[model samples]
Target: MAEKHFKYVIVGGGVAAGYAAREFSKLGVNPGELAIISKESVAPYERPALSKGYLFPEGSARLPGFHVCVGSGGERLLPEWYTDKGISLILSTEIVKADLASKTLTSAADETFKYETLIIATGSTVFKLSDFGVEGADAKNIFYLREIDDADKLVEAIKEKRNGKAVVVGGGYIGLELSAALRINNFDVSMVFPEPWCMPRLFTAGIAAFYEDFYTNKGVNIIKGTVASGFGTNANGEVTDVKLKDGRVLDADIVVVGVGAKPLTTLFKGQLEEDKGGIKTDSSFKTSIPDVYAVGDVATFPLKLYNDIRRVEHVDHARKSAEQAVKAIIASEQGQSIEEYDYLPYFYSRAFDLSWQFYGDNVGDCIIFGDCSPASATHKFGAYWVKDGKVVGAFLESGSPEENQAIAKVARVQPPAGSLDQLLNEGLAFASKI
Candidate 1:
């Protein structure tokens, strides 16, 4: 009933939190009014290049060593960035509960920070394979490659395995990327994918074949359609074999488990409305509790590309969605109208010698156009023009001059009638057929 005092109290100082705060400041709000809480001990940076150094091994200064980072663009925070912005950066802090009804965030230290509005950008953690009860699953040799800590473990394990053999489970983006890095380190690497094809959800069968052959050519053993029931270890507590559902065993000294990651929204249980591993938000990124909004991998909202359902996970997804969250906070402050946030989902991965780029299609209905075959190296580029049949979703590789433009416009919205047909020409364009 009274006028709320605080402007914003953002939890989890990752990309979303920092970007939301920067946006808030652009709206003329002072930094002293906002609280940035992060478990990482510095301001948020970027992570675009962390894997590069670990993959390259020549030890370039551009790629230093770090773990558990909430940074950006290969660099951590300068400390002065927050101070200059007048933001109260709380590091090594964790928010245990959201007292949404009281408009407060309770920390583990028995402190409550009152907020007129709150943003939760708590990201995600790697999914561990230990649940399946692989023998020696919790052993020191097995690691989930998610945070910087995982990367460090991977680096050490790869070095140790250089004298022996290493295995990676699940052939999704992370697994594939790590596979390439391990191979680069001269470790005899083997990848175990549950699915018959690589990245079955993201790429078409053709694209998958291209990558399969690519990784195989690099001397990495590729095993498909194998569901690993668990792991095996020697008496020394070192991983020695990986047991498969199909009854095959792999010998290895180091194991990198990259099954997947789930949103770290579990901490908000009972404190916020959510389905799955993310908090719910509306068009304005506002939670059911007034004055509280959610963003990043921890938040969910109807994304048009996802058929207007709350979707989570991805770097660009967080940035674009949080942009809307920031705008929502400012609009609510000024009594201005707010617009819904929707984006075409996109993701990428590097495996062996191939780079994979993807966009849209959470449920997989789409049309492919290009030399998407593994037998031919001609079409390093692949494109997809998808529609709900009601609306189109387009995705493409970074190349393909004309196709890139078409996919871009189609993602914003389908072109004014007939354009979809032109994109779907059944006749061959190179044959001079009309």
Candidate 2:
């Protein structure tokens, strides 16, 4: 028998879909009115902790779903949220295809769901160079840690190869955090960078250079100005070396390609119009296909600062975009005009020896705080007060012990020139003025 048509159908089980379901329920959308189909058996939870818990020592595995604020602890869960709302959870299923003409979605189990509105929060996957045919991968142990399985593989390798050596190929958040985790697991870690400094796309040289020394001091073999071409394996068919672009190599038991992630919209297969190969959506989060909307890493929605250039594969983007998608869906249902998603973008990572954060408008003109030290063997701590004349855009960190209260001024918007230094003398109350 065919299930009743839902007022709305949301695909994907990540934060975007979860947030949407919560809002739909809050708006008094009938308990039985919504159908949320998710691929993850587990409800939406934190994504960063995947690497953290997987890398935990034998006795340090964190209690799952437990949370504490100040001193209180409990699990903030979705099953209860879903139950109270009468949200049908079709878990462990995939929405294989949909008929835009017929307005129906066929699931893997051959179950069918028709909807008045649809959301495509399918998210994205890590981009592997094999898809691009880039050479360098041989019998080496190359890893791309994105999903739970990928992190599980890393954990297994860590248990078997404690004190082993691993090379991290990218300098992005995932790469940095994974490398740090490996080190904490007692693995010898060598971090290779595509740029002279760290997080070049996100930080000023001042802040990037600081982290260079910090990681090195924390037992990370820093390799800047080097590019990994591929990986090499030994006679046992395991990675033993990382082949470099200029014919050099780094000894390795595992090669982690933190190269970055791309939208998982590949399977969308032209069913949705794309901008730069990612599904495109308007401010309302509506895609070119009627009743279908996209969010999370799969979306190339407008960045009010980046001249509307859409980007993929960032956690901040996922959380904020998901929230925006829920708002847009609710507004539309109430016959209200949809508002575009615009906000100060933020993201962060907890790696070995430091907790780092990036907040605010990153691109555009800006002034920097701290010094861009010369790259050599000696390391220094650095911070960047990246800013445009009009507003402060970013705060770049280099494992500094400073209170960093100054960065808060720029967090809302850029502080004034010399304003940071003045705050160093003043305090958090100092206005970040132009």
Candidate 3:
């Protein structure tokens, strides 16, 4: 087998790997000392755009436009950036076997690489209907958006099936964003989920109500309390319809599934300590194995704010955790100490003209406030989650820059809420006062 060696190796070229590379550059990286291995042909770009701007019927986002760090208001790191920094990017190379004992990774092509330190940011894989034994789930034109190739396939389908009937499976961020994208492209879009409301994991019924009504107004159908049980295909094996658990069938020229994601931890399952289906790591993102760190969706680290261990799949956390892990690695190498990671959970989604931001733990009693009416001019609305008489979480839609920051502060501080009614009445003002 061909052999190579590096001081550091990042095993995934996604948001986390990109940010970690940037951090290493900032801290100082010697040429030929660092390398990134990825199965993708291109360097890391904004994955979220695959469902949003990349699907736009016009002027869609493309590579170099939404590269890593750009989402966080930092400079875009193009492939040339890696070349300029002398950081090797081994794209389109899948490391099939990893031997932690020898700190070696073997790619499918029989190429072997040895690393002094390793950062596993393999990210998450999209859950598929086929995984659940749904018949006809592998039919053509049925796409799952996780990588650029998947997004490219979906875009091609959108163009080939213009004004076609599209069925979106799942009600989380992917379903909502893709439904909106299909609608904008003149496709008859319908969303299906096994919940009463969309984004059940984060949005309360009231928040979901606003979005569902808004989507309906935009001519997108919302089918809740049911799921796509199977699929129907034409003679050519292209998806033509979706069969729901409720014994209902809907015509579908194209299907998009985003039921959920599973962390890509199978390779290290027996080698690393895991929690909640992810590789367990400390605040420094150091895995159980020495010199092995895990970040992004694959790392379930401590959430200091909640005093709990959680794995955050959002891009914000992906970037922050990668930076933190790289920083920790640098500190350890220099025999210096750094502060433990203290993260406040954050999640957000955008579709059509609506955008919502949430911070802190979602646990506790929720109180909806502000003008959440769909017909409202400003379309401003928010919700607060109180736990043990303290405001532990906050969510706001159509909030201004300052307003969103204020709500995040309220979640971090978790001020004692005297009365639910009083807090509801105060609304955004409550966060502003804090």
Candidate 4:
């Protein structure tokens, strides 16, 4: 078996891996000292694009164009960049075994890698319907968007099944984005979810109402309060229909499932301390094991701002957490101290000419503000979550650059929430001032 050793190794080539590499370069990592092992054939690109622009029928995004750092308005690190930095980009290598105690990782190809320090950036895997024995879930063209390869497959399906009926089974970020993408491609689209409103984990009823109305007006079918119980396939083993738990079957030329995702932590399951389905980590992203750290969706670290532990799966947190982990590593090496990670949860999505940004915790009493009418031409609106007489979260749809920044500040500052009438009257103005 072939063997390699490096001063640093980051497992899983995803958003976190890319950003961590950039951070390492920034901190003056020596050539040939660091290596990144990934199962993906290509270098890490912005994952969020897989569900957004990548699905666009025209002017769609492609590789090298949306690589790491670009998503955060930084320099794009293409494969050449890794080569220039002398960072080993071990693409298409899946680490089948991770021995934390020996600081070793074994690839599926029987290659072994030893590292002085390790950063776990395995990210998450999509929940497949087949896992639950959903009948006929294995049919062709039944897609899930988690990686670039998955997006590529969906794009091919979209072309082959042009102007066909598409069913999206999920109401979260992927479901909303993919549904919009299919609709944009002129496909008759229908969304299926078991919740009364989309993004139930974040969006309030008022917020969801505006989106549901807008999507309906745009000719997209919204089927809520039911789950996809099974699928139907043609003689060719291609999905032709979706059977819902509510006893309704809808014809579909393509099916996209985005129910949810679980962190990829099985390799180190027994060796690492897990919390809430992720590896438990300190504010610096260091796991319980020595010379080991975890970041991205796999690490549940202390949310210093909220005084709690959280595992954020959003791209924003993924980028920031990777940077934090690298900073912690470099600081420790230099015998210096750096501030702990203080993350303010941020999430956003765009579809059908509507864009929204959310920040901070979505807990406590939610107060709707501004004009959220789906029929309105502007369709500008926002919401605030008031907890303990303080605004803990803010959401704004169709906000300008400055306006979005203002709401982000409102969420971070978490100022005292005044009277309901006052807040409603002030609306965006309230955030602008803050």
Candidate 5:
């Protein structure tokens, strides 16, 4: 086995790893002292682009363009950027074993890596239909999107099954986005989910209604209160139909599964303190082990705004948390201290011509406002979550940049929401005033 050592090592080359590398460079990291081990052949790019613009029928997003920092409206960092910074990009390397006690990681190729400091940013993996014993789920053309390779395979399927029918199994972020992408590719699309409405976790029924209606208007079929029980494959072993639990079947040339995802923390299981199905970390993203940290989808850290401990899986948290962890690391080296990671939960999604942003926790009474009619010329509307008479969360659809900023502020400040009727009448004005 070949043995190498790095002063600092990041064990995943996804959004958090890329952003952490950038933070290291910004903080004057020494050349050759840092290494990022990634299973991906390419350097980290924006993962969200995979399900959105990457599958577009025209002028889709491509690598080098959607790379880290760019996704957060900063300079794009290419693979060469790592070389120029003297940060080792150990691409196409999967660490099969992580021994935190010895500060060593062994790759599948039997390469041993010793690190003085390690950052775990393995992100998450998608749930597959086969995991639930859905028969014939492994047939060709049945897909899940989590990595660039997965997106590439999906792109190939779109080309191969042009103008064919697609069934999206899940009504959450992936399902909604995939359905839109398939529809954009001019494929007949149907969405199936067991939820009463799409995005049941975040969007209120009123909020989901507009999107469900909008998707319906785009000629996409929406099947609710059911799940994909099984799959039917043709002689060529390609997915031809999706059998629902509700005794319905839909034709599908390609079946895309977007059910959900779990954090990728298997390698460090039982070795690290865990909470909420992720590695537990402090506000600085420091894990239980010394000189070890976890970020992105795998770190269940403190949410200062909520006065609680939680894990956020979105890109914004990924970028911000990585930066926070790196900053904490550098500060500790200098015998200096910085503020805790104070984060306000923010989530957003875009598909077709509509974009929506949500800020803060979504629990509490929801106040729906503005024109949410799917047929309206402009689907400008929002929802507010008021808890204990204060606006704890805000959701806005088709909001301008300024309007979005206002809503973010509202969520952070958490201004007292007067009356439900007042909030409904004030609408965007409520956020703007804050």
Candidate 6:
């Protein structure tokens, strides 16, 4: 078996891995000291783009164009960048075994890699209907968007099934984005979800109503309060229809499922402490084991802002947590100290001409403000989550750059909302003043 060693190793080449590598480079590294092992052949690019700009009908984003850091307005680290920095890029290699005690990883190809320090950034895996034993879930033309390969397959399917019928099974971010993309590709799209409204976990009914109306106006069918129970397949094993639990059958040339995702921590099961189906970590992103850290979607770290241990599965957290983990690692080696990560949860999504930014905890009584009417020309609106008389969270659709920053600041500061009516009336101005 082949064997290798590195002083620092990062597992999983998603957004977190890419950012961690950048932070390591900034801290200073020696030749052959750092290695990144990933199941994907390509280095980390913006994963979120797979469902956004990557699906654009024209001028779509392509690799090397949307690599990590580029999404955050930083330098794009091409493959050559790894070589120049003397960092090993072990691509298309899946680590089947992780021995945290020995600091060794065994790849599927029987290669063993040892590291002095390890960063686990395996990210998350898309939830598949087949996992729940849904009939005909494995039929062809049924897709799930999570990785680049999945996006490529969807793009190919879109080209092959142009102007065909598509049934998206979920009303989450992926469903909303994919439905928009399918529509852009000239496909008749129908969205299905079991939730009462789209993005129910974060978006309030008032906020969701605006998006729902906008989607309806765009010729997309929204089916809620029910779910796809099964799929009908043709003789060629391609999906032709989606059978809903509510006794409805929708003709479909393609089906896309985006129910949710779970942290990809199966490889390290029983080897580390887990919380909320993710690896438990401290504020510094340090896992239970020494010399090992976890970040991104896989890390359930302490949320200092909310006084809770939370796992944020958003791109913003992925990037920021990765940087914090690397900084903590480098600082410890140099006998230095850094501040604990005090992150205010941030999440956003873009579909068609509408965009929204959210920050802080989305718990408590939500107060919707601004103009959310679908027919309104401005289409601008926002909501504030108040808890214990403080504005704990903020959400704004169609917010300007400065306004979004102000909302984020409001979430972090959690200013007192002396009067709900006054705050509602003030709206964006309340956050702006803070």
Q: How do the residues 1-434 of candidate 2 rate in per-residue lDDT, one tens digit apiece? A: 47558878887876566666656665677877777787766665556676665577755443245211101122354466677778887788787877766778888888888988888777777777576665656454677876566766777777887788888888877677777788888889999877877778776665665667667767888777878876666678787888777777888877788776766674577577889768888866778886688887788777774456666566557666766776777777778876577755666666654565556666555444444343433222223343444344445444342434445446665555454455434332333332
Runs in model 1 deviating more than 4 A are 1-6, 48-54, 59-77, 109-111, 305-307, 351-353, 362-367, 373-379, 385-391, 398-405, 415-434
Q: Which residue runs of candidate 5 sit more than 4 Å off their true CA positions? A: none
How accurate locally is residue 61 in candidate 1, as Cα lDDT from 0 to 100? 21
List lDDT for all candidates, in order: 0.67, 0.67, 0.94, 0.93, 0.94, 0.93
Candidate 5 residue-wise lDDT, 1-434, digit = tens: 66999999999999999999999999999999999999999998989999899999899999878999898888899989999999999999999999999999999999999999999999999888788888999999999999999999999999999999999999999999999999999999999999999999999888899999999999999999999998998899998899999999999999999989999999999999999999999999999998999999999998988889998889999999999999999999999988999998999999999999999999999989999999988889999999999999999999999999999999999999999999999999989988
lDDT of 4 by residue, 129-157 (tens): 99999999999999988888898899999
Candidate 6 lDDT over 325-373, as tens digits, reads 9999999999998999999889999998889999988988999999999
Among residues 3 or more apart in sequence or in different chains, the pairs in candidate 5 whose N, CA or C atoms overlap within 3 Å are none
- Candidate 1, number of clashes: 9
Q: Compute each candidate's TM-score over C-alphas.
A: 0.84, 0.83, 0.99, 0.99, 0.99, 0.99
- Which 10 residues in a row give candidate 2 its minimum summed lDDT? 66-75
- Please report how far candidate 2 places residue 222 from its true position, in Å: 1.7
lDDT of 1: 0.67
Please estimate how well model 4 matches the true structure, expressed as its whole-model Cα lDDT: 0.93
User: Model 6: runs farther than 4 Å from truth?
Assistant: none
Winning model by lDDT: 5
- Score candidate 1 by TM-score against the native: 0.84
State the number of backbone clashes in model 3: 0
TM-score of 4: 0.99
- Once superposed on the true structure, which residue ranges of model 4 sit more than 4 Å away at CA? none
Model 4 steric clash pairs: none
Candidate 6, lDDT over the whole model: 0.93
The digit string of per-residue lDDT tens for model 3 on 1-434 reads 66999999999999999999999999999989999999999999888889889999899999889999899899999999999998999999999999999999999998999999999999999898999999899999999999999999999999899999999999999999999999999999999999889989998887889999999999999999998888999899999999999999999999999899999998887999999989999999999999999999999999887788998998999999999999999999999978999998888888889888999888889999999888888899999999999999999999999999999999999999989999889999999999
